[model samples]
Target: MKAIYHILNLCSFDVTNKCLIAEVWCPVNDLAALRGALEQGSRKSGANIPSFVNRIPSNGTPPTLLRTNKFTSGFQNIVDAYGVGSYREVNPAPYTVVTFPFLFAVMFGDLGHGVIMVLFALWMVLCEKDPKVKRNRNEVWRLFFEGRYMILMMGLFSIYTGLIYNECFSKPLNIFSSGWSVRAMFTELQWTNETLSTNSLLTLDPNVTGVFNGPYPFGIDPIWNMASNRLTFLNSYKMKMSVILGVLHMTFGVVLGVFNHLHFRQKFNLYLVFLPELLFLLCLFGYLGFMILYKWLAFSVRDSRTAPSVLVHFINMFLMKGSGEPALYPGQMVVQVLLLMIALLSVPVLLLGNPIYLYWLHHGARNQGTYRGYERVQRGSVEDLSVTLSQDMEEGFALGDVLLHQAIHTIEYCLGCISNSASYLRLWALSLAHAQLSEVLWDMVMRLGFRGDTGVGAVLLALVFSLFAVLTVSILLLMEGLSAFLHALRLHWVEFQNKFYSGTGIKFIPFSFSLLQSGLDQDVLIGEV
Candidate 1:
């Protein structure tokens, strides 16, 4: 139909009957407008004219068209980058509006950097609104403007994460510093009480007491800033946080499959595929995660050795024949075994359930004489069922093919669950890199610049500051930002969206006056106008 419309010049008019006919496509929403325009045209022409619009059935796929506003346009672009959703399919852009920035901020969290981002986004938005700038703006600037809202959200989320991390410009805040004094507490070691830095005194340890009792209330304690084993502390915290967040994010994706299943009316798929997938994730990773958090909370750092390491325990559980010495606590071993068994059993159900059900459907259809071998079904009430039968036949519904496809899907999901979970460690890795890099910059450039006040020293300071600023912009803002963006994109596209999104839709390109004019102009040129 689209092809015929595209080559409409080839359509002939029946001059002998004094009638002209042509097909036109318009949006379903604008059917009334189209009818009104035809009526207006008939009246203007002062002749009795008639037109008819017929609803044509489509066997082929319909184009995807997303309705979006300024806020959602950036998210729509991100969704498009993965793949457009098919017509009437679930659109991922609305979800991406929140998830994409939240994920990005998880990796890019830093109070100072987030603030800088917010300011930059604000500037871009302001520039976009300025008449002079808007008039002269290049594509690059326009692109930035288009994504200003996304940037603002990203920056806002970064600030939230940064607050949770208790870091600003790679430095911990000292708001709670007055609660403790290091030298005073350590006076028994014959240390000078007056000289120790305020940060060095504060402690995250709940056992410690001075002006205040227990650990510093929020986000890493100020003492970690000056802790001898800061990297170890930060790495442990960041890695654990990443794992927890990853599990939650992926589980959320799995939960979304329920909606997709319901929307597509695939009840068998919902029960067979989504339920098993969710159960597998929860049983293995989710139970393991719970054990990890329990270990962290229940056991003191010094007594950590008393508990089995989650990672080592997982490996040993699978590899070791019998648990000679129990790695899990009390009845946890039994629970672990049960969960493992359930997870294993789910694989076959996930693999075979759908194919078998589909085969049964086809078999029943054949029995009903509704479907005939190698025969094309006519369009009518049974059109959908006929189409399905035809497609199944065309694809060759051999048992071997079904088994192979199901096996592949099962393997992919099994492997993907592991890989996708691990992929989230990039959040920890990137955060560590950003923090370390920020520290290095401060130590190498800013530290030196703060050393002196003389003429030569001032000159040296200015030069080093300039160099540091350039490096900061290049490495932190551009390079790291781009890297985080790509990783976040991957997390959403492959890990998150893969669970629910089909991403098989064609983009909608509606017929318009401009297109019509262009076609007419091309026809004229073809006629040597």
Candidate 2:
């Protein structure tokens, strides 16, 4: 009764690694019924519809939704993971567009270019579902149609960013400047003459000193009053900006790392091990500031005791400890001196730094300890993984290694950010380039003296000029756009995935045929009429 009951409840069967072929143990009398039930069950439930490569068996009792077949022997590392929850049947259309788009836009916001991208995304989404759009069928259409929700979300994000950036079309600042109705609504910050700097022509006049400053048109020169004079050290000095952005970006990554490490509590490690690298950034900068402050005070011959905020200064100098550890062993000092120096340096690092780091680290670590420990055991222990060797596994990677993997990931993300952000500089560069290229083309046409009522020679010349301009613009867009997309993808693949993924786990598969044919199967037996 127990054996029959187990067989009856079986939803699916999957072959494991090619070496482990499923034997299908059963009484001779039931074999036909079982095979028939399996086939029917598979068809009814759409089991194995989108099958994954099979490997080892899954961890739990197979759900009724999907199944896998076992194999006798084959490739190493092949595995399957399946989603069996009925809740997945809920429609993905409504939320998908909003979710992914918003997330992406929050990350990659820019106003003027977003409108075009959104329109393009929308057109692709709409045309993808239309079989009539293309003369020949395209497999790529499936990606667009199926991913419509994500694309839609992306578009909405683009639109939102566009509003924030105050840009639209090829020349946003210029076009938006003239919209009298929208302009009237925002009373707090009016779009005055200053906003019209988009296409301002360069001028040599002493009065026109700013980057985009040009000849003024009489009364309302908005550019003159705008905050163009404010120095943006990073924006003006791109390498410096890269360093600042890199540090901030790294800090964000480290914060995520801390959470991950905490959530997967490993044994015998300091809370500091899991702390995000970023928490130290401000501390490091403060230490630098302290050095500068100390130097200035010393040079000025000001009494250290009487200096303004003497206590704060003392804290900055004596207690400063930001760059991970104190700068111990500048050269080989004697043991006592080394200890003394570390004690001296550590006042800031240990006293001020360690306490704060410990507090936050403890907060995150405590909750993560249990859950993370369970995962570590199930995943074959991080330490055991580090030294484990397998013929099929990647050459350099070991089982339990996390730090090296994370470091590579950090580099990848940093590079990706740098590359992706660098790509956007093209937006500013191309917009200006496009305007200049058009102006040059128009000037050539004007110089040709092709009157509205013209002869054949002049008409031919005008047509040739127009063709050249079109070809030139088309080439620029195609080549430049292609380069940007490739660079962007490189960043995405390297930077983002490195931090959070192993992408090496086996997926689950199950078998459902026997369950389907038998009227007594669990799904049919338990499901609603």
Candidate 3:
């Protein structure tokens, strides 16, 4: 029936001969299987079947067929949501598999929340096998079932990040906290302050004399959670971490372009386009990133004269113009000069190289046509073919037009590189919001729940516990989960994918029995079943 439908679409009637003629396009590799099927059908029908197969010359773009299995299907769906890749272009799905979940985890980290997500994903996976569930009327349930594996992986990655953050439901674990306590050391020092607050008790540095033997080896020392300046400490740490991760993620995206250019065999593009883009990014934002790290590591709290905020130093670099004067450091003047020169040089190379290259290419092809005469042109020489094919594909490229397009592209990339790097900071922003919201919920409701034991007090405590749980699930799990999901998606589509993906391919639609069956009357199938 599938074959018959395809034939019907292209069938031509031969009235005198009482026959039909048809044409069909099939993959070269599938020709043998198609022939075998035709022969079997002819034998079963007891009719003489005649057919001829010829190789078709490549004339246009072919449909893109993405090969994927159970493990990769979810990631492929994410890729398709942006746009399917062009024929023979590199598929971004494979790269997205690890990146999507990792980014989501960065924003959604919390062991308790991750555990909840994992349980939900597991339930969806289990429910997928049930026929009743497969036919579920709820769209939300259907979506969950479809992306169960993705959710599971995301939950697992969140758990890993959560562990690194030492956060479980906005509370730090006390597993190693007991051994690092400074209460014994304070007593030894004859510091008889009896009413030391939890914050004071926890913030004690182990490095101080006669304190604990060593610091906590794992995640953030749990003590940081209870410190007087906990919020300030976390804010500083998270903001700087965001910048670092942003730089690294964008750098990875730029590096991936190398593989894409190599795959497409466009070495000129690799050198002229991506290399300059990479250099500009590194020299500008990359240098600032190094300063950020240096500030964190070497900036002294006691010596205010030597340490200045990175943000101020960056501004001063641009605002303070002088006769080769070093405003921020002893030798920053030379580094800045070299970086500025390279950045300026790269701009013209990106804007002019492709147009120049194309001009020579087209000029050489025309000369070849003149020398070879009309006979060579009629025979379709390789040079003519190359020029004609490129012209057709690009709708007749001209030098001026190419130059303008290249200029626009270079400008977009240069600006986008700056904007996209800042965009990844959402990872830190959302994570901070989640943590703060969690803390608020705990203080508002859970604290009340823990306070009382008597009849009326117990009843009030129960109500508080109920309210806390409800708020946690609704606000933190459902609301924040969706928010983090969107941010993660934006990072992939705008920042990561823009680096390499062309996403202009037509998706492959194969002729299959299942497609034919689906098109059949549903009522008939129901009656038969």
Candidate 4:
């Protein structure tokens, strides 16, 4: 009904007083098809003459129409949920096809759990063509069915991350055998029974040859399973990785913005605004990312423990505090100070660059008596010119609003670098929480089944196993999946899109017989052909 009314609103009474006339806005490629359809409709209606069509040039921005088929539709809809893409703007949906699932998998990774998700989506995908299933208009089922592809992709990505984490049902798989050796500590160090008994825990020395050969061929070393400091190791790892990924993702968004500038031919924005913004982000956080990789590669196991913290180094760079820790490299002071100065300089440029340029451009126009385009006024006297300048400046471009908007924008980007970097920590937080909860479920419920033996014990084991299954599916898979999906959506919508997406355009709604046929419910409700 809304669609019908919207189309009706675009029509007007014809001068002939016997026909209604309507103007259509469609792509140039569709013009011939549209004319053919009009002629066919006129003949079918038994009109005296065929309908006429004309093309007129329009400079106004047309409604944005992004062509999408079944496989891409779901991903495109995910982007539209945030905001419709502007006409000619690069669609984030293309990239979201992969990033969305990958980020969700980061939070919800679990091989066994992902297998369950995969199977569920696969069932829906296979049954998608069934008429009976299609006719079943349960709205919730329809929503899930529509996104079967997205679900499948997320599940598959989860499997990959889970493999990397080497976790399934909260248990480490010992496929490559353990890397660390307690025996090496005792044998190589010549430790006697007395020495072994005195120590509560033995450390794996990476410096020694036999103690630690290398990383577990894949994923984490299963030997970490036996270590008391596993959480310490895992926490540091996941947190740093979250920052690394977050920085890269945001940088990509800023880089994407360059394309928008090029498309619009707004080189003023390209040089003054975007370049400075990009420089600012890279100097501060991009430098942080570089430091992360540098520290990982530079500090070998020999100095890993003694190596200075990246997080502390960053904080100290800002505070200009004492370098109490050992320098990671020589003459670090000069480089750190230079990068900080460059980052700080980018701030003023971001705050005032475009707005000031606009002000100057408009000011030049007003002084030249060419304000608001080529309506040049002859100013015979200085006093008259002064009056015109004051009026033009007041009416044409208000510098105050531009400054305010730019100030807020500049502050948001700068502070967001801090807060958003912290926001990515949720990736580590949820992943750890999911791992811990799943481990608890296994330890408390599933583990008991393995200890059972007798007839009664077997029965008890069966009951416990059933309970484990229910909890795993309901809490971990379903609930945690929802949580991860929402977080990933937030990351893309807020953190990713805000950097590049303007999203100020309205979506295109084309008139078509196919649409009317598909919208059977709306047609029936209207009760008219």
Candidate 5:
């Protein structure tokens, strides 16, 4: 037995098909002779294997060749950039998608509609193997099957946000307007015998039993009321929250950019890249934080006193901002100035600090590599190699990459924001659709004015109409939901993915499935065969 270690090293080879060339790295340390035999066999089989060689990294000797290929050359481009700290060779795509649930819920939130989406997404997962749907099956099936947990979680989030917005299928609830009604709705949910009906039915009788137990003095009724007939606060608030979150999301993009720059040995560029984003986030967060406190408590506690006045200071702090008007006093002005200064300076400090640290790390690493490279270059060994440097390369940002990046980000953000928002709209659209359809069903039952005097013909007609209404609503739920699901994924792939990800990295392929071989297998794919 031979003691050997295995490591994955990429190699490129031309296979039979031009459109599907194979490039893979394999481990074959113990199979050195097998690799040699394979290479000889491949040549005899008329397999194309390009040569890639380096002067053997041993004592001074004439340039010795090791087998590699044109495809390996491309793989080297990716690896070398990673080694030098280029755009993270591997994109953090999965992480970006993780935030989708939060984004969608903020935009389209309603428990009933979310349930509908969950069911539809589930349907996609179950029917993933259908031949007719295969073309449309990729991302939808990928998310439903591979990322099912995330889909469910996002649906639940939309439900939670809908609860906060009191928004369902456009059947809005003004929880803030009537505190007692809000309490009653929740109290009913707490009990097992909750009836979703209008307020007029409950008010028909003074009997408490009518409210819960017996056939009411009147009939079932809707207790909650919608404030607006047109635009609701729930929908407006959802959009505002989306905008705020979108701003935060973009800031995160810039911060990631800075980190990537640091990784790629571009220390100076890190601060320059991060400055704009940090400033944007500081302003956005500061504004949002102030608004949240003001809306809830009508409070703005600025530290006015130079010294702590103990209990009095604590009480007065909350009292100051509660006035609901801008302070004109000199003391309040001074406090505001100080706060603004601290917040403004935060951006510069954060932006500059990371780059300085990165610069130090880059220099330290460069010093070590240069020492080794310099030693070889000075000894006149490196110059003697037959290595040729190419200088005819076209430089500067390519129009194609810029256009690709910008076009992708623009579409992704727009569709992403709109569709995510629309998802919440389903809370209104579908839920309202549900409620309205339910109302139509009830109307059919009520229109006959059946005072226990109806014949069999009238009775049969009402039953048929009510059943038809129920079927119609069910179809609407499924149709609208499936549409939303498709739109949601479009935003994910085209809009969101384009922002930080690109179709650039070569997928990792193992060496066991090789069509051809090269002499370099001894040094590259030596341990894993």
Candidate 6:
């Protein structure tokens, strides 16, 4: 009743025959159904004249709308939370369904923690349509219930990443055949309990026969748990993965920009803007990503110390300094020089190309027969009139303005390429922090229980276990999960989507009889959008 009243208040009356006149916005594709519904309503009212829906051209920009079902609605809302995509432009929501959770999992990975999240999300999905659950209107739970599918995917991917991380509640899982031979060390030393060496840091060289077969086929090898240098191994592995994954994610975004240019029929942008952006990104950051992988393949554990610093090489490339580091591969210096030149060259093209193209196009239009539908004459009073209009058009697109716009865009792309790449390091930082925090809980709380032996110890163990469970769920799972979720959101919005998204389009708000008949609160309708 309230919706109907509000809608009626918004419409005006047709004074001619005392009929109501309402201007409603709707999609072109749904015109047939809308027409049918109007005709049906007219027939039911016993009106002699049929309803009319005349098509009128609108100067206002139409709202952006993407069709979504229950499964996709969650992902769409996630994208919308940042800002709505432009009309008829590229949609990022479909891709977000996969990327969003995978990125979250990279930070939130832990088999036990993931399993707990999965159970919570799974329950929400199962109880989605239940009346009792729906009636419960807690804002936080409602938000969670609406995005239950996203949570489910996040949990599932976390389990996969957890398997790769080989962590379950801060302890390494020995699910697969461990590549390291810990028992072999004991036998090689040939020591009884009395003759045990005081040295706690016995290094197991991978090159030593029978000591290491290979890395565990799945996750990190369990040998790292006992190794003193596990931090070095994990840090290098996670950081490298972060750069590779981040570069890939950003590159995919820039490729999407090409499609946007193609759709809009802007050859200038396709040739001048996106091309240079892609080149500049690949030449510099792409080279960095390539170097990271090359180091792993070129160097083995025995001679790893001899491997050069990737960061120092990258810095020196920018400074144009020849530090004379040993070549990792053939033609290394030549490759670096070429890459740097290409990247530097792309900046000038991006800065000047678009403005120059626009200048040529604007001037060339003055002599053309038809220049944007404004007729021009070489002589007579028409020439003076046409000159006035042409001048107006030219003034609207000033050369200085075009140049300034292009310059800002060029600088943004060049700088964003560097900063966004660095932003991905958050993945490594979060993963390490989560792992360390979980480890602390186990060592500080659970370790006490295991060390005790008497009756008081049994009672103490139970209390300690309770505390561990509370902290793990409340702090690690809930708090850390939320933190990862927000960071993932930032990555998608600022780092990934910024390559393509403009978010200038308004949102679609179509009126429907179903909405009126459903008797839903205004808040419910708002939430749906």
TM-score of each: 0.84, 0.41, 0.84, 0.88, 0.44, 0.90
Candidate 1, superposed: residue stretches over 4 Å from native: 1-26, 41-52, 135-137, 178-184, 187-212, 300-307, 320-328, 364-397, 454-460, 513-529
Query: How much lDDT does each candidate structure score?
Result: 0.74, 0.37, 0.73, 0.81, 0.42, 0.82
Candidate 5's displacement at residue 320, Å, is 23
Q: What is the C-alpha RMSD of each candidate to the true structure, in Å?
A: 5.3, 15.6, 5.8, 6.1, 14.7, 5.8
Candidate 3 segments whose C-alpha is farther than 4 A from its true place: 1-7, 12-32, 50-53, 178-181, 184-190, 194-207, 210-215, 297-306, 319-330, 364-397, 455-463, 513-529
- Report the C-alpha lDDT of model 5 over 357-441, residue by residue, as the tens digit: 3333334544576411112111121011111112112232233443343344434443443344333333344334444553454
List the candidate numbers ranked by lDDT, top first. Answer: 6, 4, 1, 3, 5, 2
Candidate achieving higher TM-score, 1 or 2 = 1
Q: Model 6 — TM-score against the truth?
A: 0.90
Cα deviation in Å at residue 108, candidate 6? Answer: 1.1
Maximum-TM-score candidate: 6
- lDDT for each residue of candidate 6 in 1-529, tens digit (9 for 90 to 100): 7666656766678888777777767888998998999999999999976786878886445678798987899999888887777667788998999999999999999999999989999898889889999788899888888888889999999999999999999999887867877677667756456545676556665676777778789888886898888999899999999999999999999998877776655656777888899999999999999999989998998889999889888888888776677777787778889999998998999899887766655567645743453323221210012223456466554768667777877888889988999999999999999999999999988898887799998999999999999999999988999999999999999999889877656678666767655645544442322
Q: For model 6, state the Cα shift of residue 390 in Å.
A: 8.7
Candidate 2 C-alpha lDDT tens digits along 357-418: 33333345445763221222224212222322231124533322344443444444434443
What is the clash count for each candidate, in the order shown?
Answer: 0, 50, 1, 0, 27, 0
Among all candidates shown, the one with the greatest lDDT: 6
On a 0 to 100 scale, what is the lDDT of residue 437 in model 6?
Answer: 95
For model 2 the local lDDT of residue 193 reads 64
Model 5: lowest-lDDT 10 consecutive positions = 382-391
